[model samples]
Target: MIAQVKLAFGIAAGFGLGALTVQALHAQAGPPAYVISEITVTDADAYNREYVPLANRALAESGQRRLASGGRTVALAGEPPASRIVVSVFENLEKARAAYSSPDYLAARAIGDRYGRLRIFAVEGLAQ
Candidate 1:
């Protein structure tokens, strides 16, 4: 009673399911540790070479750390003057503090603060 396509799909799915191992459910070696989400002032301008480069470098370093640590990611963005820069570095409190202490991040934070920082905060997150 099954159409050819339906029958073929059923057999394929059954075989696929049967072949799946526990490894499938545990694709990643472990859960992610943390994530950092950053939003800069909306009025940010790429023309500001000094600021732009610092931002670029910060994101680059954060990205590398993310990959090597096998946890979360750091994402950065620029908003308008009316908007504010928001950065959330998710991880163990100690690790997050350590990241902030890094010279590179410190420099970027200085630049970002000059732009805007209305109601910014860091909180705990269950990395996954």
Candidate 2:
């Protein structure tokens, strides 16, 4: 599934971002990847106690910068959004994926699994 998503992302990049192929983009070290996570905590206490610290450590180790976190989400249209929205900026999609799957994050994630429902996605940002 992830492979398919990456393939689609590459195709979109080839056309949408102009002459820069995936290799060229990586070679030139273009824009970073932004990971957006929307979370609804079923057990706020457990999430705060068991998940936050480990996840923070993983993010720090991965050098991911938090753009926005623990922000209330407002939905102008459609159903109500998650209770909290988190956006983290990573060096690239690969880094973001690695950080998400790292042992630290995985351990934290186990706790979250019992406490919250998450919707996460990553998009390559516009070049700086």
Candidate 3:
């Protein structure tokens, strides 16, 4: 009976340690990052024609998932948003930064700048 008790205790301790290890690994992995862009298009036709496709392709190639784009935003507590808003999610903050500064995105931005005003930023999301 004593031997059985010891074995059960040992098994419980092992499982506890395993659970703790998994939690530690998950904590270190961190949370996702979000990129938000607020755009006010001066010439919609030109912006869509020259900038949209290139920017979309660049972002998609960089492993970003578009969460929201050009949706109606009703401001609840602050100033109204720009004419268009785009939100994207990346694996992490590092990847978000990389995607924004990449050559392809930069090139697309160069074209986008000609037809619109853009404000872009990234924020770290809460861990799930």
Candidate 4:
């Protein structure tokens, strides 16, 4: 029984140490970056047909994870949001900026602009 207890404790300690090491490594890597886009569509059909798919592909190819897209939003305080809101996460601030300025994204944005007005910005997320 004592030997089993010791073995269990050793395994638990090993897992705890491994978790700590991972946290430490992640801390060194810095927090992730998030991109928020507020869009007002002038032509819904055109925006959905032309802009959304292309933008989705570009962002996906750039390693972005879409967190929220056109969901029902309640304003807790301040003014309400635009007609559409999209939130995405990237590995880092530099990666977020790169993704925004990439040729694929730019091409998609060109098409998007014709059908909608967009306000987009990036912010660094809290460190884990």
Instruction: Write candidate 2's Cα lDDT for 29-124 as tens digits.
Output: 867999999898899999999888878887799989999998766889999878988999998888999999898888888878898998888999
Query: Which lDDT value does model 1 have at 87?
Result: 42
By descending lDDT, how would the candidates be arranged? 3, 4, 2, 1
Cand. 2 Cα-lDDT: 0.87
Give the per-residue lDDT of model 3 (tens digit) for 1-128: 99999999999999999999999998887899999999999999999999999999998988999999998898888899899999999989999999999999999999999999999999999997
Error of 3 at 64 (Å): 0.5
lDDT of each: 0.51, 0.87, 0.96, 0.93
lDDT for model 3 comes to: 0.96
Q: Which stretches of candidate 1 lie over 4 Å from their true place?
A: 1-43, 46-49, 63-91
Each prediction's TM-score against the native? 0.39, 0.74, 0.80, 0.81
lDDT (Cα, 0-100) at 65 in candidate 2: 96
Measured by lDDT, the strongest candidate is 3
Clashing pairs in model 3, backbone N/Cα/C closer than 3 A: none
lDDT of 1 by residue, 66-99 (tens): 3222134344566423233324443355555556
lDDT of 1 at 72: 40
Taking the tens digit of each residue's C-alpha lDDT, what string does model 4 give over 1-128? 99999999999999999999998898888889999999999999999999999988988988899999999977789998899999999988999999999999999999999999999999999877
Superposed on all Cα atoms, the candidates' RMSDs to the truth, in angstroms, are 10.5, 14.3, 3.5, 3.1
